[model samples]
Target: MSYDLVIRNGIVVDGTGARRYRADVAVADGKVADIGKVTEGARRTIDADGLVVAPGFVDPHTHYDAQICWDGAVTPSSWHGVTSVVMGNCGVGIAPCRPAAREIAMRDLVSVEGIPFDVLNKGITWDWETFPQFMDAAAARRPSLNLAFIAPLTPFRHYVMGEASMERAADAEETAKIAALIAEAVDVGALGFSSTTLNQHMGFEGKPLACRNASREELKAYANVLKARGKGAIEIALTRQVGVLEEDQCELLDFLLDESGRPVTFIALFDRDDIPEAVRNTLRLAAPMIAKGARPQTSPLPLTREVNMDNPFSFAAFPSWKRVFADTSKAAQKAVYADPAFRNQFREDLKNPTGFSNWGRVVVHAVRNPALKHLEDKSIAQIGQEQGKDGVDAFLDTVLADNLDCELTMASWNTREDRMRELLNNKAILMALGDGGAHVDMLCDSGYPTYLLGTWVREKEAITLEEGVRKLTSDPADLFGLKDRGRLAKGAPADIAIFDPARIGSNNHGERRYDLPGGAKRIVMPSRGVEYTLVNGAVTWEQGRLTEAKAGKVLRG
Candidate 1:
């Protein structure tokens, strides 16, 4: 019998934490038909000698909701061997929105996620309003990678309670409506629900995030739908508030676990030297919850920042910058940054070390300023020493010179090596949270899969190659309930990657590209050693080049 495709003579990892073996895998009708020595004839064959063939990587967190409308391949992620992705994380998606609220929703994404407004405006068709309609539209496009979605709480809350959802707890009626909408979305194939309470997420108008003010009661109401359905997980991003509020976060996780009887994954668990014990304490607290049968996971990577002065989202922590950059035109932003009076006001605000501004560590990263371009690799402090100017003054001058287009990357203060190792080895933590399609200008974390393999497995030898592949592939699939993919098993979908483990590495250094629609620029990092990526029995990417085969599908719960 003839097969649709076959991959032969490769070291198969299988993504099950199993030892590697040399074998051949055959696919028919988009599912794995056989695995072993397949001498049978096939329509197509991939010679995988000297390469490690494993299950395709599953990215559990991404914000490709708007990008998928026009870009089926979801580049950069696809480039790094991610054959499947879960979008609409952090409670910011582009469905279930009123026609008037479309721009409003886009504004939140632009401010909080760093997607350009012009890109969204020109790229998305704005044809669908409800969750199912959006799903169907995405499916009809036939993307190059499988896509799943979650019912974003911010849009649901905003749709039900209007602008009040941005700052206040929803009333009883609004809560009930939100619950119903969530249930409907799940029924129509939304994988689950997600919300964010981090201080970093703000609206375009510089207000609190839409989901930040959600009451416990309201969130519980939303979780009840998942409980009734007997499936789906709850994704949350909350800060560590001590005392009574500490109990609140734990209680929320408990309630969701109890109510949904399913997994609950938190956004991030970072390592901070100042708060040396925070990561340990949080994990220690979560250990018992997991022992009692809960799923508590955190982002595998540290919380890294990419800052661009031209992007409003870069200064999302600063209220003044958010308000100033909200204007769509670059001319308006240039006018504001160039004005001497406005510069004085910004400097004064920078002097005040409020929660809204992070001025001290704002190093100059990228600059079109001819005077500053030579200082690219130098930190603000280093530049200050060379120029005999204050670091803040040098930063401000660069920003003004570039008219706020000067990009800067301020490393997160949390860089404890010990804590990173502990968190990386945690049994309860799932390795994920690569915000791929969003934050285009400021970040390019889509290369996390390659980085994990290269950094942890090869260079550092922190984890074995087998274990690292398991985290990138099977672990996420099992948690998210993708039955037909994620493992190199018979009858599973033949979404696979071929890479040289020794040479796999990430090249993300906060570079900009003008590849998006409307000439909108964003950050991207191309990976090395990913030789071939197959999706649904088709070769979609090979050797850093994409094929025209659009074998991807819209995945459902």
Candidate 2:
């Protein structure tokens, strides 16, 4: 028999939480046509030799909305066996905007997701204004991997209300216009709608994100389309500290889920050492809700963000720190640390008790000032003790000494083994929330699938290989309703990642690469042991290089 492609002699972890077995996977016309002993000669054959072949991971959360227009493979994500990705996440994206509103939409993406504003301006073609048109653009791009998107609330608000999007609640007419957009979006194959209440997402003017101004009434107005259609999901970021939720946040969360009548996933429920009660609070709130049919989202792999001192707006998570940095020049922003009164207020905010939760573990990597070289690779807590100061003062002083170019990096902090196991083992909590492609300068969680398998399954023994594969593949695929892509069974789409189980993790600290349009830099880390990645039975990447393959589809539900 003849086939389009074939993989011979590999261990198949079929991504269904089943026992692994030795099999040969054959592909014909982009679907897994056969398994077991495949004696047929194929047009292309991959000798897996001694690797594990699993379904390519379906990333249910990412923000590759704008990047896909310029860099189609979606990079580092496709490099890590992420054959399918759901973008336009976190309520911030570029679409459904008129030409006059384009600048603010671009600014919203730049400010909220860290894509450079110049890069966005030069990179995006702005060929489309509406959600369907945006999807068509991606489809026309014919990226090497499958892509889907959620209609974000931020752009919808911007498209309708413009600058006033943040000034007031939506009036009835605006609500109806927004709902019509949402209906058109889902009707044209968007995965769902995404909104965020996270305070950290600021606009270019440093005000709360436009989505923050979205009233629950308007959201329901839009979400009712998803409910009425009996499809799509809701992605949101709620107000919380680790596991703990404010009373109103919980009410709104339950309201969003109940009213939508579709799966609702909230952003980033983490387990923090500083807030031991945090994870418990979240589980308590979600448990009863999950029992009654609500799905919360979590990431099994921890996150690392490489932030520099000059523009370390990450500290704005602290209220007082945010107030201090409000609308300042770089010099003025740095001066806020020098002012004793502002310093006092900033320190007071450090008592957020739950703030950051991992600053003590932050290591000062490289500093722009040669004089501060001695602090390299030392933890902030250690540097603080040596300087006879607290972590806050030590950090601020170091930033000042380096003239704010210090690479004060936050390494992977939240994924404690026990905590991750608890979250991953929870069937209801989908294994997602990797802010891939969006936080490019600070994070590179796009390599999360390989990290989960190589580290958690192989190195740490926190979970079985089958379990990790299931969580990475079928769990997220089922969550987002991509039934065709997540299993290595016959008749399934031939999206697969082949790797040696022992050597499949990326480096602990990724190096920066200036690959974005306009030579803007982003944190890019390549993974190890992803020997071959096939999208729709076509080899897109192999042996550390990308192939000229574009067989990916823009999947619609």
- The top-ranked prediction according to TM-score is 2
- Would you list the clashing residue pairs of candidate 1? none
Residue 82 accuracy (lDDT) in model 1: 93
Error of 1 at 94 (Å): 1.3
Worst 10 residues of 1 by lDDT: 238-247
- Candidate 2 C-alpha error for residue 61, in Å: 0.8
| Clashes by residue pair, model 2 | 243-278, 310-404
lDDT of 2 at 479: 68
Q: TM-score of predicted model 1?
A: 0.87
The candidate scoring highest on lDDT is 2
lDDT of 1 by residue, 237-309 (tens): 7554210125557766777687777787775665544445766677666665666455544444444467755
Residue 191, model 1, lDDT: 84
After superposition on all C-alphas, the RMSD of every candidate to the true structure, in Å, is: 4.2, 2.3
In candidate 1, position 28 carries an lDDT of 93
Shift in Å, residue 540, candidate 1: 0.7
